[model samples]
Target: MPPHARSRIESDLPGDQAAGKPAPQQPAWPDPGLLDEVQRELLNRPALVPAEESAHLADLMAAVARREAVALQGGDCAELFEDAAPSPVHRKLEQLYDLSATLREQLGMPVVTMGRMAGQYAKPRSSDWEHTPGGEVLAVYRGDAVNAAEADAAARVPDARRLLAAHDCAAATLKVIRESWQGRADGNRVFAAHELLLLPYELPQVRADPEPYASSLHFGWIGDRTREPDGAHVALAASVRNPVGVKVGPSTTAADLVRLARILNPERRPGRLTFIARMGADRIDPLLPPLVEAVSATGIPVAWISDPMHGNTTKTGRGRKTRSVQAILDELTAFVRILRAHGAWPGGLHLEMTPEPVTECVARSADARTAALNQYRSPCDPRLNAEQAADVVDAFVALLRAA
Candidate 1:
């Protein structure tokens, strides 16, 4: 990384004020020298998105916060290196745009669409290692950016070389997004986003045109695992000028949520910050209203969106992780109700979905155990297929019209 960027990160910034300083879920790369070399190489590479485009997305997000627009952000849960080709990228964009179009028509408001592509190559695993069905124990698969998803020991080893491959894949995916985004009559467009995990990959991509901003992707978010108010990840997000979101789970205290809003968006820029609520269907009623009330009382223009996927995850009869489409909708309904009751805008939806017909996610009324086992393909978490995702959009439309 450049000296200026490194200094900015190491030095105390406004976001460095919170208590917990631990940065969890990072890969323990074997070779430190090789990792430094990779960071240097990435520092010399071009940014995936420009600073101006990030500003524009922030503007759109502000509109969402004001209830003048709605946003739809979705894509694969963990992007694979092999799926970086044009066909996969195009299909994903097609799915996202179609959903956004439906939102625009139904709500009579512009929809800002963001795809969890380009830089979504890293993930946060619950455990450092796992046991395979064959009784072989190995390091858990973090993401394509860290190690291979295969169960073999050699494939699970963290390698610095994969960092460069991830950057290349992201750039290629961005190229496809740009090329396909041209000549749209409806004037709809999609932006690139990913979890701002892996500081090794993120810090090097930080560029200072005048002030530092994460130029790796148009939008980056802090996952629930890494959103420590005083930790390195929060510092990284706070250091940048890009529009950022944080996953707000059930355990998040109202005071902490307010503090995070103040820390991440000190200036109270309308669209600069978003709080994505992932409270489970059973938890949203009691947990969310107080959070919304507290944050709203602060008068910060933070967008409130629903991430119904993460908190609703359940294990099937065979013990495979899956999400129920009906449970997701249930959470969405409660999310909208809580936000509206607190006088907060139900600004958008954040989802994990794919164009592929993966049966990893099934409707609640279906033979869930049997249905979730067929054609399951995600390397990490279950994602809604095209039809299942459309069902979500239809439900959101109903919620809005009734509102």
Candidate 2:
């Protein structure tokens, strides 16, 4: 948009302060200056993006809450540091833009396209340490932000300096996204996001047209692993003005959901709080209804988006992490239908998607194996490629309209 428009949106975001819940498990970085320098550098650098973009997202999220528009959040399952280069970034941007087009053309409404990249350099894994089959233990591959994605002992250990590297990589990736979308008149704005992990890197990582990034990620979220009511993630998110979301897994309770809504969006700001429900296909049918009803009763309206990726992850015969395209679709179908029954908008869909032809799960996947998956490269999780993503869009639109 215009400079004036950007300034107006930038004006709405809150200045940095204590947007955190309280202390969770804050790790002791080997060196504190590394953290300090990274934070300072982030402040000096161009806002990873303009604040107006985030404000626009908040508005878009509101429309979703009202069922007037649907959001399409997708990107790399795990953003490799090497992929921070312009080429892969450009391709990913194209995939996102194309995904947005498919939704707008068929869904017949505005679509919010938030990429799970830029600042999404951190991840929450099952273990803080991992070992090879031969029993050589490693500290575990946290993310490019903390350690290398490789399994070597040297690569697995957290390096304090990697925090700065993460900022540089995020800056580079954000540069690509901004340039790609620069001067475009399209109202469909794409926002950058990542799991709001409690690591030192995530704390200072943010972007603005011009502002400090204590919690500047355009669309920051708390993953299922860290959604505890008393956890630091919830506390930290509560304090930020940027559009914030929380992912609810199959085990999340209705009471917990209501309490979380109150904590995150006490003012009941439109699009201020988004609840991304990731109940698997079977669980979505039975588990989602009461949660929706409970939240509705509380009168704290949050954009209800479905994250069909996480809950649907499966292991192949060769121990590959994969997901079925059909499982994702089935859960999403149930998500919209159940929400409609509750007299609420499904709001949007969250996906781990890429432009590359990786086999997350597709037809004939019953026989799918790791060897069968072409270009299978994600080190963290499985994702839908362009073809599979297109398949999803087609099915999702038809299902939404039928609703």
Candidate 3:
């Protein structure tokens, strides 16, 4: 039996009440028939592992446990892989494995890897109509961050000056290239498109006035799959005045989502929708196909964002500190197979990164132990710093090129 499968069985076994020991006997590994049932539900389950990759993956895990080449700095999770040369198989795994390898090398520990998501937090709607000068925008941007009391507090500003400044600067940097190609009619659109696409993160502010920029704008939203009551939902409703692309889960029933979409886009129909289905290693086998079909019936482009790390780790009472290294690997592999079968490449990735590495999110870290991880007292932000952010970007670019 696969080590991951064995781990799943162990996790599910009942615990002893008196001695506080886990059940003594090993549960029977799923029979061949049971394995088929499980694979059938997944879009494209990987063939039984090749001997070479299996051995390599095991070696990688062991190296992580021993704290070999891994390094840990403060920044996005993907940044860890920026400097490393990825193996051919690492490309197939996309950002997850590259990141895993990086974490193992740098942190002397195994890092949990989740699937990619493509979207941004919605910008709050702006109250003003006219374009303001650069100085005014900078002041407003700084003020918003200073006043925000939550991890995403700055996300509330409808007309965020900070984002605008970034967008303007990026646009200016790309202007010469854009203008140079303007005379090439057929390819001019591509150059113009490049200018617009350079700042995909500027949506929340753009959505505040979709009409002025409607011809050149596109928007999407991102949030933690397991983190309920997302602030993005409210911000999206306020900013997404028309039907834009929406990426959601597969298990989400059709009728409910359509109704919600209708409410959000009352005057015009939304287009180019995408929904992500989460298929992890531990889910029961019978529910996969219907879940896929249900989401497909909504007439949207459906993709799967498999939660390799978080899926199995979310047990009844588990904490981040107690998560196992092997568990993270199993979940990540499951995610890769699911995405390959579903047709969408892991186009872009998202992670809970921070500028500083030793934040409160990791309980074993000093900051969290000293400060506390309570709602109001959550430690310093968990965003990736410059080097870390660059690493993640490099990893994603490598994965994209490999694909």
Candidate 4:
């Protein structure tokens, strides 16, 4: 429990403490039927093969090497390889290997197959949230301003309804991409809900749209091991950057973010909303109080996702086995404790990762001990090799368990 969290929870209880009875027993774990249903649904949906399905995945390394060689050598062999597009077999095999890299790295083993989860996209007429058997299903809205404007314009023109619908469909698809998770069951599985990341973009009209064209809401009902519906939860977070010497826009302010949260979570009364704060290192200090105030204004819970792997201010030394590695870990631990002291620990975390082990974002160090730091070009960066991605996931799991 972090600061103010215990108090917040206590405040929510009725004053009749003396008359209160023991809390109800937790729900029984769900049955296997639910898990089976989920598996069937996921397998039936159209999915992309990111990695090779065959046991001989090592063969891809050779093929990639061959392709690289052809690219490097500017001779008849190179020209022939370039002129003749890679065979379908080769292309498919390459994709299979590429995608599998991260999955294998994070899981600490090889992945035989992967599939996409089917999500239920819908719009609620009223503010009433639906209850899935497990708990609450996550519902995210696609509410980018550009899409909102297009939807508004289409509303006045009857003929433009189709165009609006197209935009809505596109928005819905983006929502799915942002929030859906690829599940791996064998090890400590990673279950992600992406809606929280899209909260800033949710628009009012789109949320109310009966058949919204540009702005829409999408949700997926996820079940735990017992195959029962898991309830829905909300996390409010943002990427931060230094603005001390830069001009700040209205949209960049914490006030703007709070306003956005209010608009997106209409069902949450001012005093009942709950949120978790995930601050990036660059803007952590200045952003902290404002975030607390904004969410607290709505009486929501706010926790922090102390992502040391990405958010830590420490830079890697010349080598991975450098003496600073221990120091960096110690600093990250202290940072987590600091956040916990500020009533921001919610026992949850968010990580940007992948399923491959190649040096797609940064070259691997020649020495195993030399640390390789990634220079991300943008927020939605896919930079991790499979092994690094797995390391991040494992780190997160370890952190959670330790907390």
Candidate 5:
């Protein structure tokens, strides 16, 4: 049997239901019974992913942590119910497939693709309400899984029905995703994933099978908002066998990281834990090294992937949410530098991207960004467009080679 994770994890973490930090911007569901219905429906549906698939993903992640392979995971920031239509789903999958082929050529190692789809229908917010320039207040624009994206109060109110709608959309999208991946001589079954938030959505899938299930999603990672050391998210991750990842933001302490490793993977397991650090370019230099050092000292192998998207995201003067590819590239460069300095493997990268042309970036002039807004169709968060993704693919390989 595996020995318990080096002690002090107990002292470092909060009580059973808590970990990481507090979950922020959760919507208040109007009716509790609707949750029960949604849970039942999800539980009754055939598992979107079988137990074996999640295990396969874990095995892949294990190889990644050992530096034998690299992970290439990305997708829409938040999938909308309508986006499940064949056109949108196929567009995204085609881009991902092309991405996989490119990475395989450049990285010269097996590329494990985890599309943030099949069920990435939910997202966490920073506020419960949005204040307009006229000093008017309205419910925040939570993802479609929580409420409609309309401007009226009635449309924004958290309706439990959206949960069921999201599930249906996710199921359909999964089917399209699988179908699209076919006929590709290059195996891309690895192109599966989800946002891994939304307790009501995930709990049914989890409770149904005590072990991890990724029928539709081969793997997933917890976002920064839900990484609280003693929170329900960690509890869910700990209870499963699927390879789990936690976003380590700027504030996460090295001590906290060690505690996380201990609590999640006490066995000194290699593939079971991944820390997707998203410290901004300015913060990566000082903040990332100590955490890598601390975790490395524990002797537990964990994949250290960089999610430069969240850390580099910003709002333009036009009130548009954007991220600079340069910022992303810069932070990733810093991440690799620190991991190597500390003698740890840099496992891979996680990005928010899409096939559509959207998002305001360095090349996207103010006029272009404003024009891109006309094409921006994401329900939540910004994603790199096809051109931007291509730029990232080439630039990332070049950067890693230089490193």
Candidate 6:
């Protein structure tokens, strides 16, 4: 690690919880020496993003806090290394642009466009092991950054070498995004973001050219599973100057949220913090209001974005992971109404989506069926298709307009 980076990691944020809990969902790597070598190599490599771009993203997020703009951030639930090709990258970018255009026209505010790309290869899994169909027990597929999604014992071992590959893939994807998006107006350009999981990969990528920030991604966030106030993930976010967010789930208490806010944004800065509420449709009315009320009372400027996808996730009869479009829309509607009622800006929407026509999601209102088992492709969570995504944005805008 760089000399300047030590203080950021060692220092504890105010009101930090007991450091007893191990950082959840971290892969149990077998070789500590190999991991150290990987980290050293990463320290010598060029950062994937610049400090200035991250600062600019912070400014945009601040606008969302002020109700001067909105943010539309979505992409693959877990990016595949093979999908780093120009075709897949370009398709995703085009989809984001299409969504942003609609949001800008209806909301009459500049929509900050961000994609879960470049470094979204790692994920926090609910379990460390999964049972295969043949009754074989193996490690769960965390993400491409940790282990292979294939259900094999050998493939499940955590490998430090994959971190290097992830970095390379991130660089390639960024290259494609910049080349394809060159000459586009900044207002329509997309930014790269991902959950800052996988400490081995994330720790080495932190840089302090003058201000500390995660140079591996334009925007990075702490997942619901890893947002412990004293956990390494929160420490990483608190130590950086880039705009950071935390996934707010139903179980999170208002007091815990307040402590998180103080730890992350001690200065009460606007763009420095965002709380993405992933409360389910049924829980939003009862669960979200208190969080909003408590956080807002602190006078800390935070952008409250709704993540309608994660909270609404369900499984089909065949055991395939899927989500209901109606449920997603319902949660989004409740999210907006609740935020506005509290005199707060809805701020943005965070979704897991793809530009393809996959049937991983069902739309009961439209008579859409569950994803065909043979055609489903995502390695992790199901994602909304382009058509469903349009429906979500359209519904959200209609409600926003009325409100």
- Measured on C-alpha atoms, candidate 6 has an lDDT of 0.85
**Pick by TM-score: which candidate is best?**
1
Model 4: per-residue Cα lDDT over 208-242, one tens digit each: 11222112212111111111111111111111100
Angstrom error at residue 107, model 3: 27
Could you tell me how far off, in angstroms, the CA of residue 81 lies in candidate 6 after the best superposition? 0.3
How many angstroms is residue 180 displaced in model 1 relative to the true structure, after the best TM-score fit?
2.3
Candidate 3 or 5, higher TM-score?
5
Per-prediction TM-score: 0.94, 0.88, 0.34, 0.33, 0.88, 0.93
State how far residue 387 of model 4 sits from its true place (Å).
2.9
Pull out the clashing pairs in model 1: none
C-alpha lDDT of all candidate models, in order: 0.86, 0.75, 0.29, 0.26, 0.73, 0.85
lDDT of 5 by residue, 50-116 (tens): 7876776787778888998778788888777778898988888788778877878888888777888
Top candidate on lDDT is: 1
Evaluate residue 198 in candidate 2 and report its C-alpha lDDT on the 0 to 100 scale: 42
Which stretches of model 3 miss by more than 4 angstroms?
A: 1-218, 222-251, 257-271, 276-289, 302-329, 339-348, 354-403
Candidate 6 differs from the real structure by a C-alpha RMSD in angstroms, to one decimal, of 4.8
The runs of at least 3 residues in candidate 6 whose Cα sits more than 4 Å from the true structure, single-residue gaps closed, are 1-21, 365-373
Off by over 4 Å in 2: 1-28, 31-46, 205-215, 362-365, 368-371
Which is better, 2 or 4, measured by TM-score? 2
